[model samples]
Target: MDDEPIWDVDRVVALTPSSAITIPETTNEFVIKGNHLTLIKGNQLDGRTKTDPHKHIHEFLRICDMFKYRDTKNEVVRLMMFPWSLTGEAKTWLDELNEGTIDTWDEL
Candidate 1:
């Protein structure tokens, strides 16, 4: 399933790879995949947090999970959960891509 993106201010937050973002307080499970953030609510048993009042609770990211990206295709791509520490060469690669100095991914 897919949901269309709306690039409005209230919808997304600009982010960099180094940005530190918090997952929800109650959730023990968190997921970050290609342009998606998913949180699985738990049963508090004490009736503190509702299991899920909505049907599609895990279907989309909350407002906090949304982030901005810089892509030419405008196809949303997200950082992987276990991000590999990038080398300094990544910046040079980004510079080349941004400046249109590289013609192919092999140059990266």
Candidate 2:
């Protein structure tokens, strides 16, 4: 309609975090195994009914525990893998968080 204002995507800035998760350096190669990724992807959270957030968190932690990297803290692995465990609204919520707001697992 003539009365409606046009939306400008170029003028809009993406509010991406400067450092959502700070991954600690590791002496050994830090790689997310396909099996682990597959498992986490299988248990993704969509922030919808019928999906238990608490359960997802617990399961995520459990999967993270199965992975280990020298000089890399467990929390670092958790932080790196947490994003993969989300989808739909859950992923959208994480993406919309303020810049540099989350730098630690506790903060996340």
Error of 2 at 63 (Å): 1.0
Model 1 vs. true fold: TM: 0.17
TM-score of each: 0.17, 0.74
Q: Rate the local accuracy (lDDT) of all candidates.
A: 0.26, 0.74
Q: Name the runs in model 2 displaced over 4 angstroms.
A: 1-14, 17-19, 25-29
Q: CA lDDT of 15 in candidate 1?
A: 33
lDDT of 2 by residue, 35-108 (tens): 88898899898877667788899999988898776677888778888889988867866776666667778887
- In terms of TM-score, which candidate is strongest? 2
At residue 45, candidate 2 shows an lDDT of 86
lDDT of 1 by residue, 28-82 (tens): 3333343233321221111112223232222222322354433321111222221
Model 2 lDDT at residue 62: 88
Q: Which ten residues in a row have the lowest lDDT in candidate 2?
A: 1-10
